[model samples]
Target: MRTAVVFPGLMVCVALLAGCTATAPSRVRVDQAEGGLPNCKTFAWIPTPQQPATLTEQRVKTEVLAKLKEKGYSEAEKADCRVTYVLDVHERPKNKPSVGVGAGGGSGGIGGGIGVSLPIGKRNEQAGTFTIDIVDAAKNAQVWSGSLDATFAKAELNEDEAREIVAKVLERYPDRAPN
Candidate 1:
């Protein structure tokens, strides 16, 4: 029937679209202290040891600040909570197998041969982990932490992309300041 043919074509189109729009794989994890998040609404950035000094760091910082503001938190010199972020990037080991095809013919006869493929080289892809931590200023201990691990084809990220990553991680945070 016409409906059956069209349905299969539409399904194929949908599958192709999905493949085209695939996003990088990412995982998010959150940890909280025994007492849970403090009811503090203000935050200050504490220096992270060996933090990467790069343009990407600046972009991430900007996005984090924006997200915090959106969550009704403000920055202050003497805030009740302190915050910090770390970005780490490294190359992932390649584990993909190669693919191949073979065809052959002989004069006055038919012949066939089998071939196996072995990968010669691989493209190096980098994976990055972004982590944000909140600490209670009075107690000087961590209150809550969120971490995102993502595989990337490139190292640089624009503002919107950076915002997307930060937003995904911060989505786990309370909708409003914790009480």
Candidate 2:
């Protein structure tokens, strides 16, 4: 009847909606130096010894550079400021019941209960943490830092996702003063 048709249609709609839904980034942690953010218009990227030059790193750097430029900052080899970033990924297991039970009964003097348990495909979760730091060239110390953590169902971060994350993290950056 109408119930049968409506139920399946509703389920389909729900599935489509879930697939199209976008997850929001988690809480961000921001720290400013004791003297507050330094005043600088040019920046250079200084990679850590442990972090090699990789495609992901390059993409993140590009996105961050674009954002900084949009904020009226320029990149320079001997600039007043330096920028560095880090990206980390971790895997976690999803929480789920290990066992399940089912019961059944019939009116014709028949009743029975069944319990079944089986190993389902492992459902692992992944999370990524991104951090950006800015240092004052004259002070030789970090002036500001921002970090964001988000969970994902996949192991790798796509370019779009990485750009979005970088944008979200940089949203906390302080605005530059008028020249």
Candidate 3:
């Protein structure tokens, strides 16, 4: 009975430790004009001329559009509001050096141990910032913006992940009533 409990407890501890290695916490920030978002029911996506559209861009746009629609907003050729999004990724070296130490001892007779410490190669990390800006079409000025920053181990971005990130960021958007 004691063995069974001990084995299960050890497995639980190991599982908990494994889960602790998940991705780092992400940061989100939102800023809106004093009067809050416009009462417009329609909006359009405006692409930046400087940066050409990419796969990730297209995926995020689609996800955001769906989310907006779910909130009673529609897409129109010429609408009361314009939406533009930006995704920026930067690579930086993790200044912290990796160190490893190991020791082994002989089992029988006189036991002796040897230890070694070595510095491992530097690891590269990728950080990304996703921002969405909502502007008043007639005024040509931004009314609200939301951004999310996160550090990731993988350099490549996937559609599903982008969709999830965009959804989380857009959660800050104020809901609009049917118009």
**Which number leads on TM-score?**
2
Check candidate 1 and list the clashing pairs.
none
- lDDT tens digits, residues 132-160, model 1? 88899999999899999976666776677
TM-score of each: 0.67, 0.69, 0.68
Let me know the TM-score candidate 3 reaches against the reference structure: 0.68
Number of colliding residue pairs in each model: 0, 0, 0
Q: After superposition, how far is residue 97 of candidate 2 from its true place, in Å?
A: 4.5
Name every residue pair that clashes in candidate 2.
none
Task: Encode model 3's per-residue lDDT on 133-153: one tens digit a residue.
Answer: 999888888999999996655
Shift of residue 146 alpha carbon in model 1, Å: 0.9
* Candidate 2, RMSD to the unseen true structure: 8.5
Model 3, stretches more than 4 Å misplaced? 1-24, 50-52, 98-119, 153-156
Q: Report the poorest 10 consecutive residues by lDDT, candidate 3.
A: 100-109
